[model samples]
Target: MSGKFLPTARFLLIVSLLSSALAVTPSAGAQAEPALQTHDVPVAGGPSGEAAQRLADRLGRSHTAGIYLDRTEHRFVITATDERTAEAVENAGAIPRRVTYDTAYLDSIKKRLDTNFKTPGTMWGIDVLANRVVVRADSTVGKKDFAALKKFLAPYGSAARVIRVGGKTERTSSAINGGDYIENGVVSCSYGFTVRKKTDPTYKAILTAGHCTITSGTDWRKSDGTYIGYTTGHNFSNGNDFGLIRAYNSSVTYYGNVEAEGGTAQDISYSRDSRLYETVCASGYKSKYACNSVGLKNQTINYTDGSQVTGMDVAFICRDHGDSGGPLFAGDAALGLLSGSNNSACYSYYQPVNEALAWYGMEVF
Candidate 1:
């Protein structure tokens, strides 16, 4: 959800959430923790990190129970339901733990909840650590809906848990077209990542929040009202929040670096997935450079407006107005695009950059 449409009521909800005991903490141990082995494995959010995630995905598809990143160990921890799968995980260089429910069982539970108990302010997704589906409900979910959700999960018993989070999720659109912001005549947003179409390297484009392009036309401009490009594609409130802007002007520049908080530029070398408990930094017009540790992965956030966004990366990064569609990265590795935040700007969510690039057939250059 975008930050633009948040109302006063939701702002209060954010305050409450922030005060809740469930708020995420920083990862001091994440950096100081000793490595399990002397040999270097891929750091989380690196190429090896991607490989680890893909390996975990394959294991999950093969009905593995759960998978999580052991950041300190620099390896994935997989839960295998059987001896054969445990042996396979050991051979694949992952630490294996025994568990009962496999990915297939967890996925079936999620499907049942989606098909029968779907509610406006409710969402559910796999939580690898718990080996169960985590169901989240926002402030907008009424008692009746929450009750229904509980009843639906009753069959699964301990396989699911419902939790309350602060603030109603909303699309972070509504930046007025003006100087210093990427604009589309009626609205403006922060540029996410500069890219070229995978099929045509010559075609330059910029990625941003898809809701930023919900206006009438695709024409785009810079903050100074300088014409830059047009929206070639966009997706919102339907699984992902990303948009592609194809530049028409040769004079326009696409930088290989992200603007740091103090006006410094940090070069991006590659893109990787966000890891749990890892520190991440975000840059946007309103908040500039803000850093925070990662919280949850594969989170499903329900907005008050009856829209539910799944597979969001939750972080403690602060965000405010006009920060939508900005870059969320960890050092040189690109991670995600700023999607929305709680009212207090204490916490935020991002659409994973890898998924966006794959969906749009584009790559960050």
Candidate 2:
């Protein structure tokens, strides 16, 4: 069964069907907010309002100040500032599981290769139950990667399974987290950009997490810039944590890459046709910077907010607040921007850059 050859189209169709069958009882307002493509599946058991409070105490705010759950999967994801915190969260039993490749649940890559399709390294799974995707990517991925995804679902069930990008698939990373990195702001990192008109060097406008704005505005951009605007509007405990940022003027220009070691800007150029398996890196205030491979792209996800974002992707390791609205890329090409993600800290959520540009009326080329 492993080596059997099945038509690519039919393979994806089967997977889609299985995914649909796994739907759980999702929060009604989840769609306009986050991922894990929940609601499609139904969750029967969960803790209630009072029970939720007792559980919160066990979780501990230091390790889970930002943790949450998808109404469907009912799995708690813990947010941490570092790997040590992640471990602590696990030890404390704040999260039912830890983020590790090939540990418990199968990683997305292994799942994709099981099928006859040839997918790039950037392949991941949308946890229809947990309301999140088992994502891990650092760089880029394209159609070839997507083609293999369908065939990977044959053993799950029988139905018309097709893995295609829909309106719900990809989403705008809160630029208050994009790259112009409009990708994740999630599963781990959020991208922040200099959204100034094509003129000034002083970042006139900036993007970040709506949640980030909710507590403090001077977390990341302090001496580098000033406050552009509050999280004028945001979604929380529901869907996406993205918000709009307004500035005095459009002084922000595309510095392009983020400032790496010694204040050097890294080059990033992402395309829809980019490869999946590639070494990639990220820069932000959280871990300073870290590296990983792009295992998948365009996966569906469910955030603690209980919303499902169709096209959001997931990363392997951990990240924190300062890292929110950062950048994820391979070489000079761009991939996704940061967005609100799992409380697990190891999983970074990203939004597609293309969609962010379209929504904000910005350009990346």
The top-ranked prediction according to TM-score is 1
Task: List candidate 2 segments past 4 Å from native.
Answer: 1-191, 196-204, 210-225, 228-242, 247-254, 261-263, 268-274, 341-345
lDDT of model 2, residue 318: 47
TM-score of 1: 0.79
For model 2, residues 240-282, the per-residue Cα lDDT tens digits are 4444454433343435566554446765333231222233455
Global Cα lDDT for candidate 2: 0.40
lDDT of 1 by residue, 30-132 (tens): 2322212211355442324445556667766545765555554555666777888778777767667666667788888876776665476555677665567
Per-candidate local distance difference test: 0.68, 0.40
Q: What TM-score does prediction 2 earn?
A: 0.42
- Cα RMSD of predicted structure 1: 7.8
RMSD of each candidate relative to the true structure:
7.8, 18.5
